[model samples]
Target: MQWSIITIGKPGHPWVKDALDLYWKRLRHYARFDHVVIKEGPLDKVEQQIQAVCGKDPCIVLDERGRSLRSVEMANWIEREEVSGRKRVCLVIGGADGHSPGFRDKAQVCWSLSHLTLQHDIALIVLAEQIYRAYTIMRGEPYHRE
Candidate 1:
């Protein structure tokens, strides 16, 4: 299965870029994964940029108040999606001010990394790393420890 990550704006810090690239490469080794970066702007503009990628594929939009899942749970969810004949999965990360109102309502799944507010750059890294961890867990790899 292929995973498409839609993130608003580019990495703010140099290290963030390096970290996401590392995880991006690692994820590709396990499954087809790629990132789509939309131009960042005010809430309205970013939301407009986001709408272009919303397609028939299932989308999991990240927010601070969405459902929380453990790494194992995420792995199981991915497995279930694949078994259900999902060809591609979309994960969306909003801009600096977060997603515009009602934007997340369109998602098939709404996820939150944590209750604490995360900067968009850090959120990108965390999302990428967690995805890598999820894939490792699915493959029974040692990269993820219980």
Candidate 2:
């Protein structure tokens, strides 16, 4: 299956960008992965851009009010999607103001990385790393531990 992460704006922090790149590289062995960037703009515009990128693909939105899943659960969810022939999945990460109610409502699944609020850049990095961790767990690699 293919996976896409659509986010608002370019990654700003050098460290976060580098870390996310590292994870993206690692993820290549598991699935086709794309890191899509939507230019930062007004809330409605950004939301539109994100939605346009997502199209009708199965989507997972990152929001504070979303469900929290463990790494294993994430891996299982991805596996299930693949098994079910849902070949493409897009994960949306909102900009500074976060997602609109409509955007969240449209997602097939909404995931919360943490209860504590995180900057968009940091959340992007964390999402990348968690994806890598989930894949490693699936592959029986030692990258993640209980």
Candidate 1 overall Cα lDDT vs. reference? 0.84
lDDT of 1 at 136: 89
lDDT of 2 by residue, 64-145 (tens): 8999999999988877888899878999888888998887997899999998888889889899888888888888998889
Cα lDDT tens digits, model 1, 61-113, are 99988999998999899889888988989888887678755878877888999
**Model 1, residue 145: C-alpha shift (Å):** 1.8
Go through the candidates in order and give the clash count of each: 0, 0
Candidate 2, which segments miss by more than 4 Å at Cα? none
TM-score of each: 0.92, 0.95
Residue pairs in clash, model 2: none
Which stretches of candidate 1 lie above 4 Å from their native place?
A: none
